[model samples]
Target: MKKSNEASCHNRVSQQGIKVQLEIIKTEARGWGVRSLNSIPSGSFICAYAGELLEEKEAERRTSNDEYLFDIGNKYSDGSLWGGLSNVMPDAPSSSCGVVEDGGFTIDAVEYGNVGRFVNHSCSPNLYAQNVLYDHEDKRMPHIMLFAAENIPPLQELTYHYNYVIDQVYDSSSNIKKKSCFCGSSECTGRLY
Candidate 1:
């Protein structure tokens, strides 16, 4: 079973997440997107969204407007981003000032990223991003993992909900910021962030 699964996630991609071979393809509208080269069963560990690990200050200097920045912050006991320093208070200022708090750590993949960066957003997605702690016991900072949320068939486009919290996307100039969605799923929310 292990060998077959390893064969599924090709070794050529990277030393990590070698359980499946993935292909980066061009989408007619969404620029670059990733597709599975083989079937991935539900609960399968896909790959880590590998990139340069960044601290908060450096992350701030780089660019908050970047699409490749991912938050891996300390979550509330309920697995939500809230330090709970005070009641209903933000743990730290979200780098994007959207709902995602940096929790002092963020992954900037704009320049150096793996195939995970190409995975697009979908309302009805087959995969999901998860926070996992493998190297250390610190739950505050964990590795961002991509797992098959459902049984994904061969040659299918891989997707995961970006899970951006809508209410917190406000800026002083714009009452609300939104990017149009082109996932084309019936459950499409018409907005990516």
Candidate 2:
């Protein structure tokens, strides 16, 4: 598009049904890219941020103020829960929708190995996370939804800003403003300045 930092974006696709897979490819200026496995339509819930559940207090305690939403208890190449979501819930995948604690909420873990974790960071991302209603009338599990921020094409790796939009929510916990632009998105501020 505008051509700012275009390295971080890639293609992704679902191999068979809802199980979308991530692949590494290349962009025009960006080298070594991973894109979508198929042509994903807009407004589609690409996949859940599946992982282990933990209480907010525990997550905060575990993360030691890392500022990451999900407490992965371990780090993956994809950047999943390295710790836990401090303000979220703590429990197993309960009915896909249940409170992990009073006033505390549960978060998806990459323990189940969801592809969404590897989506990576982008100042301008194609996908965005949406907290949709977790319906369990049919015994369905509650889950956070990932929607296309824009129309994603086939072979494009689905991506979202990993900073969690702390700036958008006015969250002062992020070090992004101080971090460098490895995402190389079109909107890469060059530096956090």
Which candidate ranks first by TM-score, i.e. highest?
Answer: 1
Tens-digit lDDT string for candidate 1 (99-157): 33435687888988888989988888887776665568665566777777778999899
The C-alpha local distance difference test score for the whole of candidate 1 amounts to 0.70
Candidate 2, 1-193: lDDT as tens digits: 5653333322222211254455755554434445677776665557666565666555544433332344222211222321122112234232334323233433434344455555565677777664433244321223545666566788876666554333332224433334344677778765322
> How much does candidate 2 score in TM-score?
0.52
lDDT of each: 0.70, 0.47
- Cα lDDT, model 1, residue 80: 48
lDDT of 2 at 174: 37
Best by lDDT: 1
Error at 72, model 2, angstroms: 14
Models, CA RMSD each? 9.2, 13.8
Worst 10 residues of 1 by lDDT: 81-90
